[model samples]
Target: MTLVPYAGSSAPASASVAELRPRPKSYVSRIWRHGPNDGVPLFRIDAAIDPATIEDRALSAALAPFAAQLQDLSIYVLHAEEVKPLAPWAVGRLDVDEKSAHVFLHDYLAAPNGMLMLNLFQAPGAVADIVMGVAPMVVEPRRIHFAITDYDIGIRASIG
Candidate 1:
């Protein structure tokens, strides 16, 4: 799989923004929809986070259960401008579980500075519902302040 940017230039809002209204300032969530029918769910967390940080490991651990159930899991990193725009990088499909999730995270961690996008493909349920369960674990008290960037689920198949 390849990481595809959400094309909507304007900020799109969703129920998640309302639900997150009470939380601290950084818990912002951006929702984007792509695909002919907008059927896929791509969740992004934009934050001042270091991919190599230990907190990220915790997140992978949290998602271990879901990854096992999923046919494929991809984590993409888009470079966010603290000052200027930079190209984003993605670490494609990973084999995740309780034991190997930590290792897979390291590949993503190698990116210098970027937003995190977690894409779950071939999942069996509703997109919105799955994201609701995922949004909470993405936040941390001090390590990183996560902003949900987009929910657009458009991805390109990797060509060999």
Candidate 2:
């Protein structure tokens, strides 16, 4: 799954915003399961947006329409993860193809900057069982409640 920041404005007169703006790169920084019954796989994705490349002026202008919402804008990290199968009877298999499913940033102007609309899109020809198995993790979290630290011992220790 690909995660991209939503450009607040519509298409430009000369060229599309996507064509002009460089796409931000994202990676799965961490993944873990929560609770029991095979648990829900939560993936923490870290994305880097270079302020130098992204035209803040253009973004600001586009966001001017929603001035009230942007009053106290705060930076936020977004992520996507795997969910359990929807079918009650479909059991035994627990493996999920993380590549086929993704939750992408859809809109940022509807409400406060903190309020995000994440949309889940699955790749074509992907297995239904796998997709169903991994659908909820991306769609469940209303807000991520986790602490961010300068250093990550969990990942480092595991890798070592």
Candidate 3:
């Protein structure tokens, strides 16, 4: 079964989900609850959101201007992922098309600013620090995020 994203503006409110997911009555009144102070769950560390509307070529097109303005540097694309065969039961008909929907996907790019941005939208705070700590800081990147919004045929990009 294909799991689509939670399509809504805000998350569902509390009371409305009584039938769907019940919360303990004491949840409201109790200050001290019964739970373990476990560390954060292991989620995808390197995650990214791609332009919702643009395709591969358009994605490149939108970034062309930025690329030109950039100081010709080699960008390293790092992918943190796991690969496994598609399960027949969950694969469904679309599985034959061979596209699995995912939330996080990103590519590294070199920019003219002499600073590497974690991504187009927002760069991880430590990226610059990591780069600077290495040694001879020769090239820096000016990262940018070009917004893409239409997925029907292609994507539309915007500079936020």
Candidate 4:
């Protein structure tokens, strides 16, 4: 699976003028394969943003192509302050309505200085079982933690 960002240079209304401007940093794209001969390929794209900014529409546009292929979507707000409360809310929204979850995620991503990570999984069976098994932990305030780590590692190893 491949993720491609928008090629246009226009900035979203929420973004600052400086963010849309080009920078002098060198751009690099690399594909890395780990483990054995049949290892899964991991693609990493890094950019230097002077003042970290994320545009909601741009993110949504970039992900639109993969919407049909995705079986599960996980969004994490890495901000230390928000993670605690957001965990249960995320799980509840996901259980009730996935579209509403996406809407909330887009709004959160558009906020200034928002640190977020999104994981999209194509395989459903194993991942869905793993997610359901840990559904309780996702809602428990004291045990709020990402439940996909185990599934991610297992999938990578199995693919290899």
Q: Report per-prediction Cα RMSD to one decimal.
A: 17.8, 18.0, 22.7, 19.6
Once model 2 is optimally superposed onto the true structure by TM-score, how far is the C-alpha of residue 25 displaced, in angstroms? 8.8
Candidate 4 lDDT tens digits, 58-116? 33333343343222333332222322332322321121122312101212323453221
Residue 59 of model 1 has an lDDT of: 48
Candidate 1 residues 41-101, lDDT tens each? 2233222212233233554443334443232223333323211211122122122333322
- Can you give the TM-score per candidate against the true fold? 0.18, 0.23, 0.16, 0.19
Q: Which candidate is the best by lDDT?
A: 1
lDDT of 2 by residue, 27-82 (tens): 23233556565543232232222323434354333333434332222222232222
Candidate 3 — worst ten consecutive residues by lDDT sum? 129-138
Off-target runs (Cα >4 Å) in candidate 1 are 1-55, 72-134, 137-148, 151-160
Residue 52 error, candidate 2, Å: 2.9
The collision pairs in model 2 are: none
Give per-residue lDDT, candidate 4, residue 8: 29
Local accuracy by lDDT, each model: 0.27, 0.24, 0.21, 0.24
Model 4 misplaced stretches (Cα beyond 4 Å): 1-72, 77-80, 86-95, 102-160
Cα lDDT, model 3, residue 97: 8
Model 3, residue 48: distance off in Å is 11
Error of 1 at 64 (Å): 1.0
- Structure candidate 1, residue pairs in collision: 30-148, 32-151, 32-152
In model 3, pairs of residues that clash are: 53-149, 53-150, 53-151, 53-155, 54-155, 114-140, 114-141, 115-140, 115-141, 120-145
